[model samples]
Target chain A: MIVEVRGLKKVYGSKTGVTAVDGIDLNVADGAIYGLLGPNGAGKTTTISICTTRVLPTAGQVRIAGVDVVAEAPHARQYIGVVPQYNTLDRACTISENIFFHCLFFGFSRPAAKARTAELLEQFHLTERAEAYPAQLSGGLAQRVQIARAISHRPRVLFLDEPSAGLDPQSRIAMWDAVKGLRHQGITVVMTTHYMEEADELCDRVAIIDHGKILVEDTPAALKQSVGAQKVYELHLRDQPGRPELCARLSRIEGVSKAEQTGDGVRVLAHGADGLLSDVVSAASPFGLKDMTITEASLETVFIQLTGRDLRE
Target chain B: MYARAFAGLFLRDLYVLRRELFPFAIRVCMNPLLFLFVFTYVLPHMSGGAAMNPTAKMAGSGGGFGTVLLPGLMAVAIMFSGIAAVALPLAQEFGITREIDDRVMCPLPVWAVAAEKIVFSAMQSVIAACIVFPLAYYIPSVPVQAHVNSWPFLIVVLLLASLVAGALGLTIGTAVKPQQIGLIFGVVVVPITFLGCVYYPWAALKPIPWLQFGVLVNPIVYMSEGLRAGLTPSAHMPDWLILAMLCFFLVFLGWRGIKGFYRRVLG
Candidate 1:
């Protein structure tokens, strides 16, 4: 494991303390994209903060590359890079200067710092903005600069807190590509985000956390499988009449585990759609099935099934 | 490795300072210039001339009010620059935005970050004093000769006074919140400047026994008196006492400030 966290707990305030991270344990493999998937205020940032040695945990042990984070934070910090949730770039300095200073802070010599900064700026396609300060760049460009700065020291482990938070779809995809490129370089990536699709698309393994506890931790496919449904069948109806009746009849179909009214139709969850799709269509025929579609279960459904709430909520 | 990290951090601050040198120089010189003009020139000229000034009457053979006020103005410049260097940046860094997160998360130990701020501010304080020294001497209405009888003692006083100012800045910077920054100027800075023996000698306050003892707690008093002792020996505090007070303030403020800084950063 490149990163290990055991029994981690953090409490804010002393007398009337609010527990931010409550006894969470995690082990991340080298070169894997691990994600903490949760809504805002779910302690993902606190957990990442503790693991990255930015914030102290009230009780627990966190080891980065086998070194105890609290006992030897400076050593731990040397091997890890963090791109915080907010843009913490030194707006007064140019992009190149920011990356150069970051490398220097990590004990890189002048020549090495300069070379690494140049390489990162080019790699992130921020070469043109090298002379521009953070304020002058677009949001995506600024985020790229922040990432370039974080990795200028060539840290083995990288922690990105909500790397795509406030970005448009195109910018988000670009950021994801940058992160994926890092994983190819053998860097262990740990990121926190509430976007379920982001977790599904990017993470090799994800932990679903809520109320300071991990509800489940597994690969995105396995997490969806844990929902105990193989296929989701949506039956769009021409009218809302007999919707409850159609849902009740659809639930009784062979291999169908659950059915509920969704929009102007009934959505049915089944163990498998090989033989169940025809049965679902037949059951919906009496209710004037306008259209029908069947798809595999997704992380969003799995998250809602496990937490009883939307990830965005 | 630690040495290199410290150098990098300090050099980064220096780079930023260099980039903003013009505005920074203006901020450092504006107050001293105004004080030098008004107290040394305007006040003396307004009340007839330097010949009728009370400070001239007190210093029978020496220059006049300008000579006495020159060192005090240097002290003021050092204090203002030193405090502004750390206090303003720290306030914004620790505000709702939390821009200092990147700095504290460096591979170096937490206290190193605080040390960098202190040392940087100390360097700026010394620079401010150097710039103000000549202006304080030449800009006054009356002819002033700030006889530096002992260059070594003068250097020592300037260095120690700047260090004390830096330490004091660190304390205020880390201790106060962003919204409370205005209070730092109104409640702390203004009071210290007025009671710091900038306009008159500490010995002259002997007649007001209560104030003489009360103003002793102000760190600027020692800096002003130390400058007086080094620059113009005719009217000044004891050399040993000035050095002792500055050293005390340096160690005490540095200790408390570093502790507070560590707490804020680690939390």
Candidate 2:
């Protein structure tokens, strides 16, 4: 494992302390992309903070490349790069200077630092804004520069905290591509985000965390499979008087595992799609079913099924 | 390896300082220049003495007030520049934005960050003292002849004074919060300047023995008196006492400042 966390716990405040993380164990393989998926204040950031040595764990053993993080933080720091949730680029210096200085902090020679800075800027498509101060860059560009700085020293493990939190779709795609490129370079990546689609697209393995604990950890495909369904059937009902009554009746049908009223229709999850579709239609016939469509189960559906709450909430 | 990291951090600060060198020079010179113009030039000339002997009537047993005020102004320059060097940057670094994570997460140990701030502030303090010295020596209305009797002693005193100022800056920078920065100036900096014996010699405060004893606790007092002993030997504090107190403050403040820095960064 490139990263290992065992029995991790964190508590804030003294008199009425809040447990931010509670006994979470995680193992990330070398060169794998790991995602931590959770809602706001769900201990995702706290887990990454402890792993990166930014926050001391209350009770845990975290090892990066087999080195204990707490006991040998300075040594462990050399192998890890962290792109924080906030913009931590040095505003006083230009983008290139920011990256160059970070390289120097890792004891790179001046010529070597300059070369690495150039390579990172080029890779991130930030070479054009190399001389620009942080204040002059747009949010997307600033985030790129921050990532560039973090990786300037070429750390073995890169930890990104919400790397695409406030980005447009295009910028978020570009960020994902950049992260994928890092995985190709044999760098292990650990990231946290509330975007379920992002985790599905980028992560090889993901852990859904909430209330300071990991609710589930598996591949996105396996997680979706664990929802006990291969496909979801949506039944759009006409605004009839008995629509709610129809929904309750459809939920109790044989082979139909769960059924709930969505904004525009009733969504039904079932293990076998062989007879479930006809079953849903027959149950909804008297209520004046308008349309019915079947689609593959997704990570979003799996997350909602596991947590019993919307991922955004 | 640690040395290289330290140099990188220090040089980064130096680059920023270099970019703002002009404005920094103006800030360092403004107060000392104003104080010198009024206390050594305007007041003495308006009191009716001739150009060379303008302040003879106001002269005490040692010399005119200009002689006494010169070293104090230099001390003020060093203290202000030193404190500003660390305090302003630290306030921004530890503020709500907390833009210091890059440096904090560097491979170097945490204490090196605090040490770098002190070293950089001390360097700026030395520079400020040098700038204030000539202004104090030549700007007075009356001829102020500061006899430098011992160059070695003068060098030692100035070096110790700079370290003391740097140590104090570290303490103030780490202790004060961003919103309460203005309060530091009002409650800490202003009072330290006024009670630091900046306008008079330490011995001249003998008549007010209570105030004299009280002001001794101020680190700036020792700095001012040390400069007095170097620049105007006739009116100064005891050499041993000045050196001893500054040395004690250097150790005490450096220890406390590093501890505070660790708490703020780690927490």
Candidate 3:
């Protein structure tokens, strides 16, 4: 394994403490793109922080490329690079200087640092903005600079924390391409994200975590299969929800695995609703709703089923 | 391996400062210039000839008390600029943005990160001190005579003082959080500025025993006295002991700073 985390535990305080990560075991193969999919505040950041030597773990050991993280953090850090959830670039420095700083930190000479910075900037399509400060760049450009900085050191393992959190569609796609290129170069990658499409498109395997525990871990295809990739019905209601008790009653009806009230309507995940459309309407008749539409199963449903709640919640 | 890593980080910081030299020079020199205007020119006219009474023995030509105080004030300015230039930025990088994370990943040990910061800050201190030399010559009223004999002592003391000030900065930077950085200036910097003998000598504070005792513990007191001893012939403190004490404080504070920095960054 390129990365191994066994019995990892981190408790915040002695009294009234909370376990950010509860004895979780994780493995990432060499050159694999592994996704740590979780909702907000689900211990994903804590896990990445420990792996990257940013935060200490209360218990457990992390080995990167066979080097112990706690025992030899600097040496282990040599084999790994991390992109934090927040952009940590020096906004006062230009784009090229930002990347060069990372290279220099890894003990690269000036000439070597310059060459490596140029290569990464070109790859990230940020060559033109080399002279611009981070504050002068767009949100997408700043994210790319962060990515470029992380890879400038050319570590064997890369950890990305929500690399596409606030990006638009075009920028998100561009980021995906850059990450895929890393895997092609035989670099092992570990990332955490809530974008289901992002995880589905990029990751070879994913582990879903909730409330400091892993709910399930599997390949994206297997996870979709486990959740019974069936059609989902989304109802657009006429008025706001009046009763939760009535909604729960409708959810328990035949052919429906779950029913929950959304902002303006109810979402029903049906198991066998090929011709059961009218039945769903009759079930929801008491709620005085209308404008229903059906769609295919997605990773959103898979996430909801594994955790027994929506990813956003 | 450690030497190469340290050099790399050192050069990188220096390079960034070089590119922004114009604005950096203006910002650093501005503080000392304002002090010169208020103390050398405005305060003398405000106090009229009251300043002449205190320094009548050394009052020669137009220069009097203002001339005597110029070198001491320049030394204090050097110390302040050193801490402000590197320490504030270092603290911010470590706390908020975590830009230090990249540097910590170097093959060198974690303590080298703090050492590299001190080295750069000391260099900046040297530049700040040199700039003060020319300005002190121009500030009339305090017409400081350029005794060529004081060059060696001035250079050595300035280097040691920068080390002490930069190390003190590192400790303060690591001890506080990002939000409380402003509080550091208000609580620590302000007190050091007033009690450090910047405006007067330790001998002048002899009249107030309680204030004298309090100022005795301030490192800036030693720094200011040492600078005055080098620049001014009739300075109050024993020059040799002042130099030795400044060296001791630099080594002690630097050792403590490196220990604390590693514990915080690597732990």
Tell me the whole-model lDDT of each prediction, alpha carbons only: 0.86, 0.85, 0.79
Which model is ahead, 2 or 3, in terms of DockQ? 2
Q: Please, what are the lDDT tens digits per residue for candidate 1 over residues B224-259?
A: 999988887447788899999999998999898888
Off by over 4 Å in 1: A232-250, A259-267, A271-296, B51-60
Residue ranges of candidate 2 with Cα displaced over 4 Å: A230-248, A251-255, A260-267, A271-296, B50-62
Better of 2 and 3 by TM-score: 2
lDDT ranking from best candidate downward: 1, 2, 3
Model 3 chain A poorest ten-residue lDDT run: A237-246
Model 2: per-residue Cα lDDT at residue A170: 88
Considering only chain A, what is the TM-score of each predicted structure? 0.88, 0.89, 0.87
Clashing pairs in 3: B66-B142, B67-B142
B91-126 per-residue lDDT for model 2 (tens digits)? 878886577788888777888888888888888988
Candidate 2 CAPRI level: medium
Candidate 3: misplaced stretches above 4 Å?
A: A14-16, A233-295, B41-63, B91-98, B142-155, B177-180, B183-186, B239-244, B251-267
Candidate number with the higher DockQ (1 or 2): 2
| Chain B alone, TM-score, model 3 | 0.90
Chain B, TM-score, each prediction? Answer: 0.95, 0.93, 0.90
Q: In lDDT terms, which candidate is top?
A: 1
Error of 2 at A71 (Å): 1.8
Write out the backbone clash pairs for model 2. none
lDDT tens readout by residue for model 3, A1-313: 9999999998877797988999889999999999988889899989998898867889999999999888887788888888887778876678999888778778788899999999998999999989998878777888888888888888999999999998898989988998999987788999999878888899999998877787888998888777663767777666565546556866777777777777777888778656678887776776776778787676777877666677888
